[model samples]
Target chain A: MKHVIALDIGSTSTRAALIARDGTVLDHLRRASGHERGAQAVAECVLDFIAELRDRGLRKYGEAARGVGVAVPGAVDEGRGLALFSANLGWRDVPMRSLLSRPLRNLPVALGHDVRSAGLAEARLGAAQDKDRFLFLSLGDGIAGAVVTGGRIESGAHGFGGEFGHLRVRPGGRRCACGAVGCLETVASVPAIAEAWARASGDPTATAVHAARAAAYGAPRATRIWRQAVAAIADAVVAGIGLLDPRTVVVGGELAAVGDILFVPLRAAIAERLTFQAPPEVVPAALRDTASCQGVALLAWDLLAEAQR
Target chain B: MKHVIALDIGSTSTRAALIARDGTVLDHLRRASGHERGAQAVAECVLDFIAELRDRGLRKYGEAARGVGVAVPGAVDEGRGLALFSANLGWRDVPMRSLLSRPLRNLPVALGHDVRSAGLAEARLGAAQDKDRFLFLSLGDGIAGAVVTGGRIESGAHGFGGEFGHLRVRPGGRRCACGAVGCLETVASVPAIAEAWARASGDPTATAVHAARAAAYGAPRATRIWRQAVAAIADAVVAGIGLLDPRTVVVGGELAAVGDILFVPLRAAIAERLTFQAPPEVVPAALRDTASCQGVALLAWDLLAEAQR
Candidate 1:
């Protein structure tokens, strides 16, 4: 029974899974990412988690795991196996592959961007399955996107391709953390929506989910906030459609969990904004939280295949 | 001397060339496109031009031309060999390949978008030569762009990819011919700049060239209009850089001919707008008017290679 160890290191949580070649999760583990402790500590925690997952796979499957795939947030140099920069993790140019391979006895390691890895999973085994060209957007704490073409993710020349969140949808609108004004993330991301809803509704702790529910219940203020977010997202999506001409747009992350609340108005807004571009089908992601794990597992399998060749 | 007959059908003129496999123009011809006469007449003129170029190639090379590649404006269904629609040529769903092939005794015909083909030429033989990932932007009467990656153009799923001109830069601004408001084309295209310059300079005949020259000479009105156009163009290019992350941005078409006038401030504006993304080299195209013909010639050569395989 061939299997691989997959790990996804996000901002707050680290997820590990023993995945079979067919994308089934044989076992899973979760832990606090501890990114607040510092980058080195987080790296140590990741290594320990991978070791635990590998031991579990060996004990159950009675064989060694084929390879390890690690999906990290922020800019990555996949070809060089470096985690270039991650604001969430406070890391820069961490030699991830060498650091992992040393303790793992020279096991092959594959490194990829977390959002892009999830997009690969969606393209191959989830929402956009069998789609050769599509855009994968994750509307989470901050928005991120992946442009998949011909079954491969376009990482661009400098690993900055598909930076959808930074696209300026509203000129001179809001200041983003990335030092850009009027970025899509400043208006449509989960935190952005929550902040706007909280201010408008006078509920200091209101979340995006609360805003969606209020909008669904026909609250004018919440409806306006949700509608503005949806419109901004649609504007960015329309711009992406004009540039990429994708066949489908697979959206995931926290907001998509509300289903029709986010999708219904989103679809309508996109249709209203489109003029000459072809309309791409907008659908929810199927894999949910485990998408990055599954995607990284696929990367591990690819590494094994490459090693064989 | 193996060669191909390449024809570029623009709105005002049809240009033909006998091109060697190495991308050299062995011979060239030009005639009125006759698009004003109607779609049918334009199609006839294109076919006639191709036949004439084929005869010339045969006479000079002492052999039959291998294939024909036609570069047309507007939407193109390259896989189906159909010219889907062209606002300039006023044609829709023209069976370009069959029409040319039948008259030329079953010679293979390749159909391509004029802007995309020109981009291919720039990618392969012009300014972006040796660059595997780049964006080729033609700033003509209207702006158009092509995203070239891994030595191939991304035509998108619906053939509408690289519609850079239609990217919305100013929200709720002037309406575009494509029925969209605030498109980059409405503010930065050659005609757009020319119109603004004409109105501001109180000269109905003023063109973009005049605006560039006047701005160069420090004329206040022309400088203001030129700066506004450059700012809009920079905004759109910044968006493209965020999405595609190309290594180079090759600027072509009529406006690029202004040399330092367009490149100087345009480069400065892009530099000012970029934040986190990698800055791509902004350079002028080398092939000029012959780019589309040479690009279509490359397409013709590709078809021949495919047939041999």
Candidate 2:
């Protein structure tokens, strides 16, 4: 049973998984991805984490790991095996594959963007099964998205694609991290929802889960704020459907935790605006948080198989 | 040498062609369609137009047509080979395949939207050749678009997809036929451009072509209004890239006639807003007004070949 090791390096944590040829998770582990002091420390910690995973695998299944796949936060050159930029991890032009492969005794390594990896997971194993032409929206921190069409995550020509959060839904509404204004992330993203709820209800730590729970009993502020955020998301989704005509849309990240309370209004708003656009099947992501790690595992599987072929 | 008859029934006229196995037009003809009368008249006109084309084909290639392909504007049900709606042509719930097949010998008929046919044409022979992931935008009497990804046009779950021009770009700008406010067509489309130019220049009969010519020579109002329109288009394109991440964007219809005068600025606008969108090659549509007709011809080719297979 040939397999690949998948690693998703986030700002605060790292997720690792060993994926089998049949798309099953052989084993999985998680560890801290030291983001406190910047690039070098985090990179070294990641390399150690992956090495430890390999050691654990060797102890149990001995040389079963065919390769390793890593999902980074920012721009990456998977073909060139380089991390162009990772803002959260504070890395630039790091030869990630070389760093890990050299220490792992020349094992093959694949690298990809985090959202893209999650999109691959959705296409291969989740709600987008048996279909392509979809958008995998990662709605946390700041909103970013990955396009999956024909089983290929669309990487823009210049590695500047799927920046969905910067589409300026409100033109000049809110200041965003990307130096843009009123992006969907600013209003409809999970953090935005929490912030809006806090500002509206005078509770700074409000969240999507808290709002949904409150709205169940018809809390006025929670209902108003949540509906606004959901409608905003619907606007972005409608714009998405208009442009791409995706067959399915899978919403992931912290926003998905709100479950059907969010989905019910989201679906209605989308249906209302979808007069002439392709009405895609809006659904929740199945794999949850570790999806991108698993997806990156699939990338490693591809690399391993291609090397053999 | 089996073929399909593609009858593109539009508001003002009916066009029919005998498409060969390789998407070549063996022969074609055109005639006026119908008006305030009824769908029965329109159906009869379509029949007569096809008979004329069939006769012309015998005169030119000395052969009868095989299968059938038809592209109708409005909500098409390509899955069931039906036209669910056609506001312009006054068609609703029209069993187009059966009606058009009455002229032929009941050969197979594949139906799609007109812009989708153009997208198929671009995918096969035009600017989007060899590129499966792309979009075809047409600026005509009304604005509409089609999406081609992975060698297929997305007819959507209900056959209404790729309506970018209809997406609400402005929340409270203009009234659209679909009862939407400030759609892309209301600002950046041919009518939008012409209306903008007319209002800015105080000329009632000013056309988009006139506006482009003036803007090319550095007319102040023309430049201001045209730039706004171009900027709006760019904004929409950026959002599209965020969602679709297509590699090529083919612009068709009258506005493309301005050549670089239109494309150069439009490309710059799309480039400015992009962060990580697939580097889409923005170019004028290769096929002209007959692009969709040619796309239907490609479908005609595919349908006939599949029948033989």
Candidate 3:
């Protein structure tokens, strides 16, 4: 029985999970990212998590795994196995694979974009596993998306294929960190929902989840703001269906916590936008935040399988 | 040399040509589409063209061709080889393969959408030949597009892919024939350009090409309308780039006939909409209205090559 390590580095947290060859979780550990400690320090912390797992595996199974697979946020150069420009995670052009592999005595490591890795997990082990062509959309702190077609995710020319956030939802409305106005992220992401609620309710302390609930329940101000956010999401989703025409559309992240309230209007908005005869299936993501971890595990699992072939 | 008959059926006319195994055009013929003549009449005209080409080829080369290929102007099911619908040509669920195959002694008849067939031609012999991932956009009486990626065109799961006309450009501006509002084709196609010209010169008789030239030379009304049209096209182009991020984008059709008057502003508009990186190389299409015919030729050539393989 062989085992591999899968590390998922996010903006606020660092998580390491040991994935068995059979796709089962053996052990899991979590830690704060403390990204303020700088890139090298944070990476060293990630390495420490891997080392603990490697030692545990060696003591129990009498041998260590051959490699580790990691997933990081933002644009990635999958061919070169690097994470590039994750503004949230404070990482840029980090040779995550090389750094993680070097200290582990030449054990190979694979790196991929977190959202794309999550999409791969869905394609490999979740609801979209049987469906080869679909989109995996995650609306979290900031919005991001990934395209999975014919059993492989499209990484674009620059591995930035699914930056759905900056897609203009409102022309010249909200100025975004990307230096664009009216980006989808400004309207639909978790933080956006909270911000909109603050503006509407004048509370300034409402959580995004609670704000979404108030909006779903049809509070006048909450509903007004929520409707606008949902409308923007629908625009992106509708455009996506028109362009990609996938078999299914799987949505996750913090915004999806509202479930049917979010999907009902989102689906209706998309349907109203289409003039064509056919449309794709829209569904919530099966795995929540843990999806990225599973995706990283799947990547390691694939490498091991490929090596055997 | 083996030869195949290819017919490109458009709204106003039906053009036919004979292509050899080496991709050389043997003979070209033309006929009226006769929208007044109805479906049966149109089918007869196409069949007549193929028969004439077959007889001529046999007389000149002493052999009948292997098969027939027809590129129709509408929705097509390429895998099952069916022309599901055509708004312009008035074709609906036309079992083109069986229809043409029966008359031609049960030989294979390959049927495909004109825009997709044109994209195949561009990918095989035109501007996109050197690129693996590129988008072929055709702007004519209506807008249609095609994606050539990894050397294969994406036909969508239900054969409804590349319908770029329906992409919402202005959001709640004008109702389109496709039932969507603010569709790119509503404001950027040949009719749109012609409409702008008519408004500018106060001459409803002014053609799209002439109007484009007038606008390029600084006619205020023409410039205003043309600028709006350019901005709309740029928005749609940016949207497409954002979604697919292809390496190259090839533009053709009636709008392209405007030449540099169209390309210059259109390119600048697309550039203005881009952000944080490389805009794709936008160029004029190498193949013209005869694109579908050549693409049909490529299909026949592909079939013949595959048979040899």
Candidate 4:
């Protein structure tokens, strides 16, 4: 059985998986990324993970890995195989595909934006499988999105096609880390939500999970903070609907773990904001963390197929 | 010379042109659309316009029109040749292409959304000709838009992809005609600007042009009103860049005719709002009212080419 290696190089940690061509995860491993050391070290970390995964695949399957796929957080120029900029990885203009494939003899490498890879996974094997057009938004410590059209993610002219979280929802509301005032990220990100809740509830160490628990228990201050974050997210959704007219909106990330506390009011808020626009169905992400792994593996398999042709 | 009939079926009037195969307007005519009569009358008006254009082309140019293209303002299913809805035209689910093509003898007909057709024109021969990705926004008495990518307008899943004006920029600020609160249309449209200026200056008869003149002359009250409208439009641009990351933004319609009074400040405001997102070049529409006519003609030409293949 042929297999492909999918590497999800995240900010804090890296997840590597050996996936069969039929979309099954045969084996997977996770370890700290050591990105704090800088660009070269991060590249080394990804390279080491890929090397280990390839060796494991060769031993277990009696065949060398077919290809390798790397999904990273940031603005990526996929056509040029460059990871342009990633706040989390603290890297710029890193030639990801070339760097990762340098140590291998003839392994083909495919690189893509993390969220877009996950969106591809969702479109093929998860909740958005049937949706021809949808916006997949991941609200974690920060917010990001993937714009899927006609069963493929659009990389846009500059590969910034689906930066929904950077949308200015509250103009003059809060200063964002990206140097913009009142971006959706400033108000609705996981840390932002937790900080807002902590300030309002006078609990210095309150986490987003704590806020969600309190809100679920009908705590007024926690509820207010949650609603504010939901409203901000809803505003971004409404703006997204107007811009993309997606058939569905798939919400993922840690914030979505709050479940009904986030989605219930989000749906209501989006409904209220809509007029002539058709409101898309807002639902939670189905695949969770493994989405990028499967998606990139599929992408690697596609590359291998293309190479054969 | 062979020619095609391009008809722009707008709310108030219908404009038709006999366009040469090489993209020149050979002959043109315009008349009231008679939409106030009924949907059937509107359909007849389009048919009549096409017949006249075909006759003129045969008599003067010595060639019968090969095809017809109709651009209507609404949600159009271009594939099905259906004009799904138009608020100003007060029509719903009209099979425009089929109705118009019924009387013709094997003449292929194409239909498209008016703004999207105009956007196609801009992408091919107008302000956005050099831009591979751009948003064409027309701010008239009402606001509409077209999202052009790779030289074609993206008709989203529901054909509302570029409904930029409907975006909730103010959120609970003003009631839009679409029954939404704080939409960009309610704040920056020509009528909206005129109404705000009229209220502030206590001049009921003041139009958008008058407001522009007053603002240009440094009238304090008019300047304030103009700035407010510009700010709202800038906010919409900021949101657009975050979502589409287009290379350019083409401003059309009556409000864009205000010239530097709008563009000068709009540029500054957008520049201020932008951070990580690339600031797109905002320019005026070059083709003016002739855009839809030219664009539909192109579409008709494309249809003819396709049918031959």
**Clash totals for all candidate models:** 0, 10, 0, 0
TM-score of each: 0.97, 0.87, 0.94, 0.95
lDDT per residue (tens digit) for residues B1-309 in model 3: 678888888888877878876556777777887856766777777788788888988998788977787888767777677777776766678777777778788556788778988888888778898787777889888888886666778777767667777778788778888788888888888887787678767888877777677788898888887888878877777776767777888988888877788888888888877765458888989887778887887786676677778
Candidate 3 residue runs with Cα over 4 Å from true position: A37-42, A59-63, A90-92, B35-41
lDDT of 1 by residue, A1-309 (tens): 689999999899999998899888888889999999877787788888877877788889998888999999888877888888787788888888887888788789999888899999998789998998999999999788898876778888887878889998988899988888999999889899999999999989999999999999999999999998899889988988887789999999989999999999999999888887779999999988889899988988988998899
Order of candidate numbers by lDDT, starting with the best:
1, 4, 3, 2
Minimum summed lDDT over a 10-residue window in model 1 chain A is located at A148-157
Q: Pick the candidate with the highest TM-score.
A: 1
Best-performing candidate as measured by DockQ: 1
Q: Model 1 Cα displacement at B108 (Å)?
A: 1.6
Local accuracy of candidate 4 as per-residue lDDT tens digits, B101-210: 88775999999888888888888778887787898898887788887666557777877878878888886689888888888888888888889889988999999878
Report how far residue B46 has shifted in candidate 4, in Å. Answer: 1.5
True C-alpha contacts between chains kept, each model in order: 0.81, 0.49, 0.49, 0.70
Q: Chain B, model 1, TM-score against the native?
A: 0.96
- In model 4, the runs with Cα more than 4 Å from the true position are A200-205
lDDT at residue A94 of model 4 (Cα atoms): 89
Candidate 1 residue A280 C-alpha distance from true site, Å? 1.1
Task: Give the clash total for candidate 1.
Answer: 0
Give model 3's TM-score versus the native structure: 0.94
Q: Which pairs of residues collide in model 3?
A: none
lDDT of 4 by residue, A1-309 (tens): 789999888888889899888778888899998999987888888888877877888899898888888888878877788888887788888888888788776998888888888888888888898898899999888798888765667766666778888988886698888887788899889899889888988889988878877988999988888888888899998888887788999999888888888888899999987876777999999887878888888888889898899
Whichever of 3 and 4 has more DockQ, that candidate is 4
